[model samples]
Target chain A: MIELVYDVHHQVTFRWLIALYFYFTGMSAGSFVISTLAYGFGLEKFKPAGKVGVVMATLLLFIAPIMLLLQVGWPIRSVWNHFTYLNFSSPMTYGAFLLMMYPINCLIYGYFMFKGDMKRTKIFGMIGIPLAITVHGYTGFILAFGKARAFWNTALMPFLFLVSAIVSGLGMMIIILLIRDRFFTREKKINTELIYTLATMLGWMIVFDLALVFCDISVLSIAHAEAKEMTHLLLHGELSPLFLGIENLLGKVVPMVLVLTPKFRSITTITIASVLVVIGILFMRFVVVYGGQVLPIV
Target chain B: MAKTRYAFVIDLRRCIGCNSCSVACKSENSVHLGVWMSWVKVIQKGEFPNVSRSFLPLLCNNCEDPICVTVCPVNANRIEENGIISTDPHRCVACRYCMAACPYEVRYVHPIKKFVEKCNWCLHRVKVGLLPACVEACPAEARIFGDMNDPKSDVSKLLAKHPVQVIKPEIGTEPHVFYINLDNDAIEKKRKVDVL
Candidate 1:
């Protein structure tokens, strides 16, 4: 048996601030994609969400990087340095461009949509699809490039993050659509069919997310000595409560069951599932950023 | 001409776990109280009469293929001609990406300035023909610092003569820190090495 006598602990590099940053970026990317669906892909059904989606997308993107500045010591310098000198090898460099371009595209897209210029709105929306994907996808790439953290180093991290962003975006869209129809519009009525369709989409996305996470965990559980330890940490160790109980159980699984089940497809159940998904995605970011480095590598 | 490969060798057999190197590094670098650029790890193994303790001096590996340089968004971390990887305080955004990427966990955020800092093999001292504070203060002479390319240097001689090992070589960082008589127990212990 061996026991540690003395060792120094450093503060976790990416904490709640980074998690919030991830959460907001995911929210922003999700809504941007949703906004693009009606205009860019010409999905006529998603027309109603197109306007509000662009608004949420832009505002959330604005707030996301503010969390990043607070987390880093030098905020103004960071912004300056990102443009002046960039190491393209770094995944963060990719985000600097995406974060700038995506929001401007969002604003332009929203502008045209509001001005009733369908052609211009469609053009901007098409441009935003890749920007939205890259903005949030690069965050995953940042974590993946941190090769020391076993959980963050996976190749599928970008795809996992992208899919989850869409899931959370759909969750927010349902709630937003309801509030808009009931309170914001001239006719005070809830669009049950649109809400149901969005909820259905959210359910399938969560299933896809679960399958991806299962693939990641299953491989990591027996990958290597350290990988096994990390899997153990999430499965039944200190982070298990957050990872298993809140993130998987309360967040993804419950929401999936609620929305996917036909008997449970009432307004109340769908709303609760939507709320759970938003909360769950937030926790997923926490689990990902914090849990990745919770266990010491050296 | 080939670049000089700066390397460090820790003779663990001579390391009595005195922590003089740690103290010397702190006072020289003005490292804050809560963090350390260099420290010694102590581990105890076995039970009672069979018990044995080992000391591991922890510092930046200054890898030949330093991951920190590759990931710095602002290009703050630079690999000098002498092989010392240096971080520019003015340029660093305190992003902590390097700290997370480093396998040795050698990097730290300055408690006040917030920019990341780590052991740079005492480039300031080495450039002016002085030994690193840690090397000079080591009463046991366990810590040897020098250019690995120069056959006359202590680091090169010790590295050539001793059975040296580097931690986590599988990641292929090509770490420069070498250890003599490294105890597996010191590193292999399955516990959170860092205490919050």
Candidate 2:
């Protein structure tokens, strides 16, 4: 057997902060997309979560940029450079611009929603839908375009990111509604139909996310030896416990089973499943961002 | 006149791997500790009596199609008129995207300067008509740097005389750093034997 030695020089350049940035940005995008579904598409069953989703998206958007700025060595220079010296070819340039625009649109949409201006809220929702998708999808493109990390170089990456974003967003929305129902809105019961809708949506999103991941691993493992080795590392090497245990088992399969089973689809069980899904998606982001960098290219 | 295309031709047969070039790079650039812009990567293969060691000195390839320049969200990394890939400290946000995009993984964020940095083939020295610190410090004269665009340059002549290979050629970055008489094992992806 040819032993491939890991070189120290190929250590990961990015850390947890970068992953958190991706997580928050993805959550923001997912939440905003959910809001648009209700307000723009006239999904009345989703109306209860629509305003909440926009509010959460706005807050998350504020936090996401802060996470990114913290990782930058020169935060001030980064801000100046992003606006003044944008590279048209880079996805990150588009991401920076999208991050800026999406949140502003969300704030405007939120204002209209708060004022009970359905007409304006719908208009903003229509505009915010594409912005939100691009914002999160662009993060995926940033990784997909890397071309250096064998694990990250694929077209499926953006689609996978989009699905996971929606899953995480739905989970967060359910949790927020649950908390609001219990603590703030004691006089009013949380909508059972809304919870069921989000639970079902989360269930299908997880399936799609899992399918994409399966495709990514199977395709990568078959062709290039380096990619195969990286996939093996994820599946059977040091990352196996995190990847197979937390990400696959707790994050995907168990929650999937809980949400899909009619008997276990109670609010309590659904909440627990949503929490697990959120945690699982976080681990997924960790694997993609950190795990992809673990293997040295040369 | 055609613009200059600078390149490095390393003769692995002659390299002693003493790591003087690494030291020279540190001192010359005042690079911080625990970080490096250039270093020697040692790869050992075979068993006992058959064992052989090869030193692959790692530095920025200054690729013809540098992904670092392409991935930089800001125009911080750019290809100069002479085809040398350079990072402007003033413009760099130190986001380290270039570091991630680089197939060679040769770039780093400077601890103090707060900017992404890598070997630009000692452009200052080149402008002054002198050799890079690593080249000057190589006691074995293993590293040859010159303009590949010039037919009379040492690199051009060496390319004509020897079978040269670039690291990760399948990635197609078109690296300018060429290795002459290198072991194939030295270039293969290394597996981690330990983890933290």
Candidate 3:
């Protein structure tokens, strides 16, 4: 008979604040990437959201690094150490550089848009797409490279992060645009077709996100003992309510159904679905960051 | 001119689960409450009459290929010349990447210092030609410490005589700490409790 020992050396070092950092950074990257669809690629469907997306991405990018700064033991020293004592082997060092560069790129993009310089704005948007992807994708890489946590160790982490970022960004854009339409005076009628296009985009992103998560859970459940134990904790253990109910049912499924259904595709329903998607992605970040640390390594 | 590699050899047969070494390490390092640099993990195996309790004293493995050193974004954690992995409190941003990267999960952020800290094989004492506090305080002399490069060292002699096993050998960390006469059951048993 195999006996289980009760060793509790593992304590969660990263907390809700780190989850917030991941959320904001992903949102920033997603919003920027979505902006590229309109500004960089000249997609007429996303054209109306071009300036708003860049503005939202710039604001979110500004907030993301502060969230990280708040969690460090010596917040003041981080600036010096990040530059002077950089370790190229660590993904976090690369992330720091990416975070620094991404916001500046977004700011420059926003400035060109503000000046009505479409040519320069498009050029910057083209450059911003890869920067935005790397900024948030590197966050996933940070956890994925740990190799110590079986749940975090996966080749799919960067892809999952990038997809989720786009989903959350689309969700935020929908809500913000809806609010802007309702409260702020517009030179043109709020484009109903554009809203529908974004809802469809969100629906597909949610589908892709769900598929990625399913792949992750299915693979982990079949092999890898430590990962199986973690999947058990996520699926059937104490975290089941958050993972199954909040993230899957309310976050992904409901939002997908609300956006995709013909009868439920009204403005109010789409707004509600978008809000749920945002909340769900936040919970996903929480689960990914905290759930991975629940199992004791020793 | 071989590089000095310090290591630990613990004879599980001699360990009585007394936890004297834990106390010695705490007092020697002045480690705060609710955290430890070294501690004895007691596991009860089997059922009723067949059951036997075993103690595994857990500490930093001081791995030759220390993941903690590689994962630190600010290069706060470093492997010393003698292969002892140490953390610089001033330099550490305390991002806890080292704590997460460590497969052994031995590193902890000191609540008071707010810096990532772990056992450095009692380098302060070792520099003065003294044994680590845990090794000195072991009443059963269960803990052995020495330079693995020195053929005449007590640890080298004991390793030569006995079949020894390192914890989580598949991790490929090349841990310096080896266990003598340890049951596979005792080493491989999964912890049943939620860590967080």
Tell me, by TM-score, which candidate is best. 1
Who is ahead in DockQ, 2 or 3?
3
Which pairs of residues clash in candidate 2, taking residues 3 or more apart in a chain or in different chains?
A: A4-B190, A4-B191, A5-B190, A5-B191, A6-B191
- Give the alpha carbon lDDT tens digit for every residue of A73-92 in model 1: 99999999988988989998
Show the colliding residue pairs in model 3. none
What's the ranking of the predictions by TM-score, best on top?
1, 2, 3
Model with the higher lDDT, candidate 1 or 3: 1
Model 2 per-residue lDDT tens digits across residues A228-276 = 8888988898888989899989999999999999988899889999999
Off by over 4 Å in 1: B193-196
Clashes by residue pair, model 1: none
lDDT of 3: 0.86
The parts of candidate 3 lying over 4 Å away from their true place are A1-10, A186-189, B184-196
C-alpha RMSD over true interface residues, model 3: 2.5
Cα lDDT for residue B126, candidate 3: 89
Winning candidate number (DockQ): 1
Taking the tens digit of each residue's C-alpha lDDT, what string does model 2 give over B1-196? Answer: 5678899999998999888989999999888877888888777777878777778888889999988888899988889877788788888988888877788888888878888889999988988899999999999999999999899999999999999998888888899999998777876665652222
Write the residue-wise lDDT of candidate 1 on B11-128 in tens digits. Answer: 9999999999999999999999999999998899899999999999999999999889989999999998889999999999999999888878899899899899999989999889
lDDT of 2 at A240: 86
